[model samples]
Target: MAYPQELINEVLDYLDSGHSVREAERRFGVGHESAARWRRLRDGNLRANRPHPVKYPQDTVRLALGLAYGGHGFGLDEVAVMVGVSAPTISNWKRRYVEGGHMDIPEIDLGEIKHLSPDGRARMTDEELEEYIHKLELKAAVLEGTVKVLKAEGIDDLSNDEKAAIVDALPAGFTVTEALPEVGLSSSSYYYCKAKPERPDRYGRARAAIREEFALVGGKRGYRYIRQRLREREDPIVVSGKTVRRLMAEEGCRVSYAKKRRSYSSYAGEISAAPDNLVARDFHAEAPNEKWLTDITQFSIPAGKVYLSPVIDCFDGMPVAWSIGESPNAELANSMLEEACGQLADGEHPVCHSDRGCHYRWPGWIGICAERGIVRSMSRKGCSPDNSACEGFFGRLKNEFFYDRDWEGVTTEDFIGQLEQYMRYYRDERIKESLGWMSPMQYRKSLGLAA
Candidate 1:
């Protein structure tokens, strides 16, 4: 948006009247660049009669062209001010003059005779006209090459802000409209994309809440779990899980952990006699405590391995009792059996099943079972299927709790605490499809089996 000659004169008048350049620019609503150009032109003793930087009328456009070649030491802006137009417009008029050797001033006749000089080249020599034509042709070729290069650069793939920046960085005389087509963007789309995206205040508030809750939960829970827990609050807020996920994506929030695997071993050689495979893979139980499964599984952390021995009632997948220690020994198994015996009321006698590992076959383990009036059952040697129920418990426990965690920072005591917490959460919070979407405690409660 070029200012008019009147404004430029006003700017110049202010400077000549001893006003600062900045003050002159502020008064004329022009920038420092325009003021500096005015100063330079004035210093060069150059003045245009009435040049406008924006547009030129009919006769003015032709007069601008003629003055450019008239050889009165007229620069483009000097020639432009003679009829109130820009240097680029003066240049465009020059392009027409040399290329066509005639003024095809259709839109700019202004009731004037049409010629570079009066009477159609009456005042100009043939050689001078020819030379001007040759120079104009060379300039036109360069301009065309520049435009072609710009078009071939494929700036269309750039982002809108990037394209806008490039357009802004163009030479002073060029407009963004000229560069828009080269970048294969419409003027409307460029302007629209350059504007900032508006988001609602609720959106900001919701994102804050999501971040707070996500951070509060240790950031390990996925979006689904986050959404579920949010709904479970005392003052529940209804929000879609999909919305939660979208907000998570916007915040760059992710579940803190990925799944990894671990392996453990049990002492398998029979230091004592191995029991018969009494349960024989008949894992189904018609009532609580009818059949029980026990196993000693190991968890390895950076601190070292911590062992867990648990008694699970096959009837409900319920962990009746469990013991954890730094070592998986006969004491671990016996302590767990003692807890299980305490879980039984006056009449309940469960057939305890296990793999043929030394922990289960140890004299301490067998003596406890005998004293508790519990039948002892074992898998065949190195055959896991015979104790598939017990093995299945280990698989489920590892898959659900142990496999996906980072235990590198955990000590044996801390790992034991976390393992116990997971067991409690599994019993009271985690749901199973086979249990009709209820946790073990919930299912027992539903069946009137617990106080």
Candidate 2:
């Protein structure tokens, strides 16, 4: 059934040894047809040696016969593997053999099968495949040129459905260069098909532009003033204060108060009465309310000159009591001292330190301190450092609170109310860098002091 190389060689050797076909078939697994084919090859070679006219070589015929015999019942793939050719080439040879009834050797030139039609001739000549490809290339170039011209004229705005219809209408397997240009597109149009749409209006562009203009003019005017100015001029857009504030932020503009000259004096006479460490040596205190510092500072509120006297503890710098009145007399200062004394424990003689202002010079004030066992300490006259704690407190109050506001609009009552809130916040919440960045209440708690 199957003739291996070894079997074919064995059959040939048996024939060469003068063995009969029947004997060779019995010795080798090869059939009688294989023995007859091998003998035909040997006889054809011997005839070629006589050299009358060797038109076709015996080896060529032998190769063809071998391929045909191997491909007898085998598939093209199997025949290709056996003969060392591609499966398609094997298929072509098999097709030629079936149609022409002979091996389609290169030496046999069958004068162009002209009886067949053009399509049939195409099927016959393998070289004709190149001509077909060249024609396709030419058609693609023409279509590509047409698309470029149409795109240049802006007449190629076809919808996706229309474009797809155009594409599907073309011949199948047509190159992109050929197909795209017919619809007035470049080869790149196939890839970048969709056009970019128009951009929509920016929502806050008008407001943003107005804000930028306001900032460019300098944001010294209030939002209401600016709005009034714009309206009086009959501007295109009306804007609210909130919108102006938003615009101001966008334009990096800030409205700040202008600084004024210091209007109050820190003069306090009669400081020669007290000795240096006897009445005012150590400023340190271990806990809140242990020692207190007091001073009078003046502020110009809308209600006219208001005197603010605040009592602060030396230990944690906590404000114990404060009062704002029209005068810096002894009554106002004593009232604030009395309120501060109320915070002290019974029989507690907390040292009270202050500059010898006219308030501390009054007998009623001294009597109150004497009754409360409060040691009254006066600072050296004209030396602010002697009462530096109170001076520092006043500086912070002005820097952080008073200077940032339009003071011309603030009343005494409003200032007092805001001061109360600030005092509470400062004592209970605000962290002090001196107290390890902890609040006064927190520092007191850490030192085991009662509220």
- Tell me how many clashing residue pairs each candidate has: 2, 0
Residue 153 error, candidate 2, Å: 56
How high is the lDDT of residue 153 in model 2? 49
Computed on alpha carbons, the lDDT of every model, listed in order, comes to 0.71, 0.63
Q: Kindly list the per-residue Cα lDDT of model 1 for residues 1-451, writing each as its tens digit.
A: 7778887787887776545566565666778777878877978956566433322344555566556665545577765554445787677666665555766533334224223334554644687667556544543443454555457665534565555555555555556665665444568878876664553446675677778887775565577666665656676645656677888888977864433343655756768877677787889899999999887877777899889888888888999899999987778888889988998888788899887778877778878888888998877777778877766767766655676567887788988898999888877877665687678899999999987
The C-alpha local distance difference test score for the whole of candidate 2 amounts to: 0.63
lDDT of 1 at 50: 41
TM-score of each: 0.47, 0.41
lDDT of model 1, residue 287:
90
List candidate 1 stretches off by more than 4 Å.
1-196, 201-210, 239-253, 256-263, 270-287, 301-303, 314-316, 346-353, 370-422, 425-439
Q: Which stretches of candidate 2 lie over 4 Å from their true place?
A: 1-262, 266-282
